[model samples]
Structures are given as structure tokens and as C-alpha cells.
Target: MKTINFTQMKDGTKEEYDFLAEMEKPYLSLTVDRVLTELKNQGEDSLSGYKITRLEHGLQSATRAYRDGADIDWVVGTLLHDVGDGLAPQNHDRFSAEVIRPFVRQEVAWVVEHHGIFQMYFYGHHYGWDKNAREEFKDHPCYQSCADFCERWDQSSFDPEYDFETLDFFTPMVRDVFSRKAYDPKVIKENQVFGLPEPIFHKLS
Candidate 1:
């Protein structure tokens, strides 16, 4: 493939920028494959010594959400809610939230972002933290939703014998979600309510 010749962004022609944007689409597609590979790799170990691998826990969470008639965003969010553990264990929820924020509803992203604190309601006491630590954000609109996510999907997902579906079963959904534009103008506009730059809409369009 012919590459742009300009060493500096200010020297690039419109044609070069256009070519780069078009090339980005294929690279975006590759990101989905890479994410899937990473998810599979996460199965090699149990989280915090849990019996099931993180992959199985993810599958179990997604399976439960699927059986409960959750939407694609919800199921996919459950599957990836902890995919950042390997790279961002101390603040995995934030990294995971950003990964799916572009592809999912804001509500789903909020649940993923705050699931760690919500999860503490179940076991934080073991680490000398308040079990009700999540209460600190009781006034947030998505508080109940995140609470439900931890209660029904995340905290309960460590079952080793559950008939959870395989990662293959959710592969198509993963591809479909990531295939969407990473920054839809409409979504960006809505996200402005949360402090994302309004100028991003023009930049994307």
C-alpha cells in the first residue's frame, strides 16, 4: 500500500488524510479480532483464585444475561466487563468501560465502569473496606442498574459447573458491536451531556 509522504500533520494534503481515515476502517476491524484473542487468553487463569477461569466467568455472566432476555449491548457488556483485568487490575472497570463506551448504550457503559465498586457490596469487607462502599454514589442515575449487574451477572459468575455458553457463541455479537463506528456523531452529541467534547461531532463527521 502506498503511504502518506508527509512527516508532519500540517503538511499532509486532504487526500492523504482521507486515505488514512479509509485505512482506519480495516484497522478497526482488526481490533475486534484482537479483543477476541485477548478474551480467550484471559481464560488461562482464575481471577483471585476463583475456580473458573476469567473467560468462563465472562461466559457465565453473558449466559445469564442472555437467558434473561438482555439486549445485545447488555450481554456483550457482561462478556467484556472484566477483559481489562490483565492490563488494568487496579482500575479495570474504567478501562473496560472505555472499550465498550463507543459501542454500547451509555447505561451499559456506566454499569461496566462502576461494577467494581458495586461488586464490593458483596466482598469488600474481606479487605477492610466498607461493604456498602457503593452507597457513596447512591444518587447517580445508574446506581440501581450497576447494582443489578453486579448482583445478577458479575458477582455470581464464578460457577465452574454452570452450563455457560462458550466464547464462540458470543463471537458474532462481539464482531457486530465492534464493527459499528467507534464514535458515532449522534452518540457523541448525547455524550456531551457527560462532558465529552462537543467539537468531536464535527471532527468525526
Candidate 2:
């Protein structure tokens, strides 16, 4: 069956739905490729006025996570945390979270989803917004995790001079991540809060 025979979802037959699901497998298998392409596009076009490109920022974040001995999920999550900015600037954090939710741990997704609010602690006061806005999530299991993510990886990644890894260096890691079984309970580890690894300090010359 090349296509479904129904004009509307309400009229689709079981056989047709099954066929569609089977057809989706090939597209699903290439998810990592699409993600990588989008990340490269971010290097070409992203929000202006930053010291580095959006792709550079993500690479720096992931480089930091990997150098700190974070697991693959943490490193990839940091790499793609801002991916949705090009298409969903208004709430890119949540959008980016959804992009990785099926593959990474729940704790990582939670941090990505809420990092926007948590990040306000750095510059919101300059605009008269409540810098403490993230305090509302203080009772949640991943609150501190999100706070630490913003402080270490997200907010601190804008320096153009930082020696970040190239996209090629992280492509294999990205493939390893998105290739996982989607939403596997063992992979998600719901509500688990293995917070960010301690920074790996490098002495200045």
C-alpha cells in the first residue's frame, strides 16, 4: 500500500493504518540525519548579536558536558537544547525538549524544557523581569538540575573564543542517542535526577 485509502482519519481502516506505520519506519530511521542538518543550518542562520553562532553555542555546551564526563544523553541533550530557536523562538526550550524527550532521560528533558525560565536569573533583572522566576519550581525533582544546566552549559556558552568541538565530533554521539528505542522506560528513567557532572577545570596558561 503506497498510501492510505481514506480521505479522513475517521475513515481509515486498520490495514491502512498498519501500512502507514510501516512506511514511517524509514523516515524515523533517518531522524538523526535531519537533526544534524538542522544543526548545521543553525550555524548559517540564527539570532543575531551573540558572540558566536547558535551552532557554536550548542557545540560548546556539548563539549563542556562531554569534558565533564557526562553520559551520552547529557551531552546530546545539551547540544540540541536550543535547536528549536529557529522555528519556535517564543518557547524554544519546551520545543527543544520535545525534540529529545523520546530518546533521552526524563530529567534531561525536564531541564531543557524549563531552562528558559531558569536562565532568566542571569539577565532578567536588567529588563525588570523577575530574575527569581524559576523559584516556583523549587519543589520539583529536577529544579536544581535545570538551574545547574543553565548556569554551567547554557548561559556560559556564548564566548566565541571557547575551544568547542566541531559538529563532526558530536555527530556519532547524536546518532547513538536518536537511534535508541523511543520512550523505553529503561532509557527515560522517569523522575530521575542525576544532576550535571562537576566541572572539569582547565588551568589557564
Candidate 3:
């Protein structure tokens, strides 16, 4: 069938649902391309008043992580860490973390999620905020990693003179990372993956 007949999901037959599911898988597989495009557009809206554009900063962070011998996941995480800046600036850290959570290790997600709070150490005091705000999480297992990310990648990535790699240099790596089974059963339970098209049901119900 060209399209399902039901306007509402409650009227959908099992075969119709399965057909829709099969059709969706290919679009779902394009998540990586969509994410990379979003990252590429990071500098178009606002430069955030930094010396370098968001795209440059992201590339610089990833370049440093790769040069420092980080694994593929770490490099990708650093590269797209500011991706959330495009849509959600205040909670960009969490947004970024959620975007990569399905494809990366839990540790990488943790670092991405908390890097914003950790980054406050660099200039929070300048803005009348607490520079030591990150200290509250000093005992967390990923605390040091987040702090190191802020120090070595996130915070220090604003230098315009840095010899950073281009977004093209990291495109293959992004695809590799995103190609992994999303929300792996070993890391996240199979049931928790929301394994089917809930949106169609919920929205059309």
C-alpha cells in the first residue's frame, strides 16, 4: 500500500503497523546525517560572542581529543558537544548528551551531560556565578573526566589560532559512531529503547 488507510492509530491493523514500522527504519537510520547537518549549522545563528564560531570550537575540541589519543566515542562526543547550542542553549549539555546517549558509552554521555556545569569553573566568577559550582559533584565517578573535558576540550576550544580539523575530517567518525546499534541492550535494557514507533500511536491516537 502507498500509505496506511487509518487516520488514527487506533484503527490501524497489525499488518499496517508493521508496514509503517518497516518504512520508518530507513529514516531512523539517517539520524547521523541529520545530527551532522545540525552541527554544521552551529555558527549560522549566533557566534555566541566567542572569538571562534561554534563549529570551529567543536572541531577544535574533537581535534584535541583525537590528538590526545581519545577513542572514537570520545572524539565524536567532543566534536558534537555543543550541538545543542542550535536549539537549546540553556540546557545544551543535557540535549547533547541525550542525542549521543544511544550511540555512545554511558561514561561519554555523563561527561557530555555535565560538561556545562563543569565548564563554569572557567568563567562563572566573571559572570557573578559560582566558579566552584562543579565542586558539588567532586565525588561523582565522571567528575574528573568532565572537568578534564572542560579544561582540555570544551573551555579551551575558543582559540581562533588553533589548528583544528575541519568538519569533513570528522564526518566518517560521526557515521561510524552513529552506525552502532542504538541504545544497546547491554548498556540499556531492550525494553527501555522504546523499540517501536510510539509517536505515531501517541500523536494519532
Candidate 4:
């Protein structure tokens, strides 16, 4: 299996860890911490009646895609793609888009936006494919981007939001809405992860 590692920084001193060699994977420290903060607030179950937490779903979705043979970067993007949902529906996609834009290729950011397929269907499409959705979506720069990205989506598994209260995945990951927490200053340092470009948090604060 492929191996991953990390090096902690302490006052300009770096300490490295061979995670795979040590039987660990440390790629998602601060990245995941931020994602978890969002999950902690999602508070729901999946559409299949299974306990699919939003936070967990994002993590699991990434895992599912990976198991299905996606690359490492896609895995990370899928996992934290919806990190913005923890903020607000409209705002989250933009926030996540920015966060992932610099680090990944535009495609990754597109995936992050389309994770909210409902948003795409409603705002971007016209009951048809992207060609039909383009005009409406073109109204907003980000929404237009989502249209192109969503064109190649996997639609076999249906996601119904109407039953969200009863649908686990639609349910929030956390029971109560978490107070909008201030993001860490360190996030700025991640601006160049090669997936997400700008500070996705721009939509939040």
C-alpha cells in the first residue's frame, strides 16, 4: 500500500514521522480538524436509514470513492469537499470552493460544489443536463462552475432531501448547531495545497 508521513514544526524545527512505515497516515491533521468541526455540527442520519453523519458521510464518501479507485487527491477533496456546509447552504459551497481551489485542480473544487447536487439542480439546471442548467447557473460565477463539474456526476444512488429529518445523511452531524467558530489562523498557511486555492472561509467571515 502507498505510505504517507508528516513533519511537525516547532519554532522552525521540523520533526518527521514515517506514518506508513510506522503503520499510520497523518495527511489530514489540521485539514481534518477543520472538517470535523463541520461534522460536529451536521447532526443527522443517512437516506438509507443508516446513521450517515454529514461529517462522517463526507469522510466516508471520500473513502468510498477511494475504495472505488479514485486517487489520493480526489479522496482528500471528496472528504473535505463539503466543509462549507457547516456554515450555510449557499455560503458553504463558495467557502469550500475557495479553500480547495488553490490546492487542487479546478475539477476538485467543482466536485466540492456539486456535492450539494440539490443546489445544482435547483439553481443551475432546468430539469435536464448542464446544457439546460448553464444559463441559470451562469448568473453566478461559482454556480456556473458547479454546472460543468456536476455534468459527470454519479446519479444512480438517489439523494432525497425532503425526508432529511428522517433521512440520516440529510440529518445534521451534530444535534445542535455549533456556534460559528472562528477559523484558525493557520488555515492561511494551507492556501497552496494544490487542490483548494483561496481561503474558502472567505464566504464565512
Candidate 5:
């Protein structure tokens, strides 16, 4: 595909948004208005070709995870998992950890950091960089934490629409983008045990 700003891509569509406008806002009620706004305002085209705006991808992942039955905290972690992308791309694992702190549980937030390793594996495979995936993950604190995160909870326990009232967090703005996310293979596998057939929600992939 043509390389263009996520908001201004090959289709010439222009979507203006700022993902961090709500960074300073309190997340006391977990309002959909607040969360959905954050999703829309954020741009999606990757500044660094090395990856997509991780925040955008994380939001998609969380949405997919939640729609399939992931818990609230896990869903929350998915949304904020990569907020640190621009500020600390290489170190954004903690950036995500830091961003999600005020709203989610310490343990689930820890899992957000852990997601990096799994992502590196997934991304690396997607991008054809198998060798470095391990090196990149080797020393990260999130690595160990994620292993436990996966083991502590199997994918089956997650429910996609658990706190659907929070759909506002993803609706109007983020849902169009979020809904397009194809379910993660691991995520799908867990749900498949219960007969959740994977469906293509987006046309892009």
C-alpha cells in the first residue's frame, strides 16, 4: 500500500485527532465518551516504518480481546498498551505500563508491559525479523510478567462485551477502526474452544 499519514492515506481521507488530549483527564468513571474520544483523536499511520502506531494496534487488540470476552482490566490494558509509542518507542512497554496505571489494576497493568514480548514475536513474524525478536525481548521486565499473564488466565475466560456500557469508550470514534481488527490468533484459539468462529471484521487485511 502507499505510505501516507494514517489520517491521510491512499484514499485521501483526512481524519484529524489527538490521542493524548485526554491524557490529563481523570479516568474515574471509565466513561465511553472519554475513551472513545481518545481512540478517534489518535492518528494511525506509523511514524516509524518499523511498526504501526503501537497504540493504535493495541487498541485494536484490546477491542478484539474484549469483544471476545476479555475482562475489563485486560481490555483497558489493551487500549493503553502502547501510548508510549511516540515518546518512547523502544521503551514504550513501560510507557504503556505508566499510562494505564491510574485506571487499571497493578497486575493487569503489568500484563500490558508483558504484551511487548508477545507483540515482538507476532510483529517480528509478520515483518520477517525472527532473529531479533528474542534479543529485543530477552532483558525486558515485561517478558517474565507476560508469561505469567498468559498462564494466569487462559484466553477462554475473557468476554468481549463484559462492560459494554464502556462501549462509549470505543464507540463513535474508535469502533470503526477498532472493530476492523481481525481477532488475534491466540485470542481466536481460546474462543474457538467454545465455538467462536473467527470472522473478518475489516476489509483492509
Candidate 6:
């Protein structure tokens, strides 16, 4: 009863499959812990040439979003948007998006999935790549949201001197996000474009 008796996919009984599902609940519940651990690991090493560590970059991005009056989904999505960079540098945006897609709004996930291309507007030209490559998604509802996310949070977050919140400050928000029922349509809000709030600091400035 402790383990599924069958090695082959076609051989498992319903009782064994149910047992496995039951066993997975604890692991699934610890998603937030695993994510937090990865974020902490990001702080242990700096990406070459960047003035700040990846963890700091994420903290800055989340702080900006939180200050902008973004909801929990937006703030958490922005925080983990680069989590995939450690393992999948080539297409980290999409990979990061998948990591949160099940528990967040569809609009937020879409922005995360495409933020990489949208970000090219900032530095792709230095290497002779098309800076406007993101134009291909101009018609998508979340395009502007993604652009703003990159401009306001992602691209502007490398400053070492910026006062960013610590990972502990965002731990509750992260736990709240990951605790949601996975893929709940009520939570996903497909095609709903809750775009970024006007920058709070902009008004102050």
C-alpha cells in the first residue's frame, strides 16, 4: 500500500493511483518553500557584469510592483519572473511563466511568458538584434502590460543602490499565491487585462 505495485502505466489499479495522488499532496503543498529556496539561492551568486544579484533584481521588481498598487498576482509574478534564468537562461521568461501559470491570472502569465521579447526593446540593439522584435505581439491584449512590466520593473531593477525589499518581506505574498487551487478559472481570469497601475513613485517625483 505504500507504493504503487505496477511499473507500467497500463497496469496500475485505481486504488494505487489514488494512493499516489494522496501522497503527492504534501509535496505539492511545499511549492512555496521550494520557490523561496530557489530565490534565496539566486542571492548566493551574482550574474556577471550586473551590479546586483538576481535575488536583488527580483526584490526590486516586486517592490516596484507592490508600490505601484499591483495586486498580489502581479507582484508575485514580477518577483519570480526570472526564476528560470538559473536553469533555462535561453528562454527563462517562458519557463518562469509556467512556474506560476497555474495559480495566477492568465494575463499575468502571458506577460511573464513574453517579457523576454518585450525586454529586447531595452538592449537588443546593442548586439544588432531587432529592438522592436516584440511588435509581433502588438495585437495581443497583454502586450502593453508586458512592455510596462519590463520598462517599469524588469529593465529598471539592476541599480545596486535602489532600496528594494528583502525576500522575507514577500514570503507571505508568495505563499498566498502558491496556495491557490491550481488552474482555477476563477483565479485565472482569462483574457482579463488588469494592466499595471500608474507608477506611484512617478507621481511623487
Instruction: Estimate, for each residue in 43-71, the C-alpha lDDT of model 5 and write its tens digit.
Output: 55345553334335544555565665655
> Candidate 6 regions off by >4 Å?
202-205
lDDT for each residue of candidate 4 in 1-205, tens digit (9 for 90 to 100)? 2432434333221223333434433343344455455555664522245345555555554434444455444555655566676566567766776665555544555557655653445444465545343344444545533443233222211232212122243223211111222232332233233332221211111
Which 10 residues in a row give candidate 4 its minimum summed lDDT? 196-205
Which candidate do you rate higher for TM-score, 1 or 6?
A: 6
Candidate 1 segments whose C-alpha is farther than 4 A from its true place: 45-48, 185-205
Better of 2 and 5 by TM-score: 2
Candidate 5: list runs displaced more than 4 Å.
1-41, 48-56, 123-205
Clashes of 1: 0
TM-score of 4: 0.42
Ranking by lDDT: 2, 6, 3, 1, 5, 4
Q: Residue 108 in candidate 4 has what lDDT?
A: 55
What digit string (tens of lDDT, one per residue) describes model 6 on residues 95-161? 9999999999999999999999999999999999999999999999998999999999899999887
Clashing pairs in 3: none
Indicate the worst ten consecutive residues by lDDT in candidate 1: 196-205
Question: What local lDDT score does residue 37 receive in model 3, on the 0 to 100 scale?
Answer: 86
- Residue 48 in model 5: shift from native, Å? 5.5
Residues 1-205, candidate 1: write the lDDT tens digits: 3899899999999999999999888787798888898799888844767788888889999988887777788889899999898889899999999988998778788889999999999989999999998998898877878888887778988877678888999999998888877767554344322311111111111
Alpha-carbon TM-score of each model against the true structure: 0.85, 0.97, 0.86, 0.42, 0.44, 0.97
The regions of model 2 sitting more than 4 angstroms off are 203-205
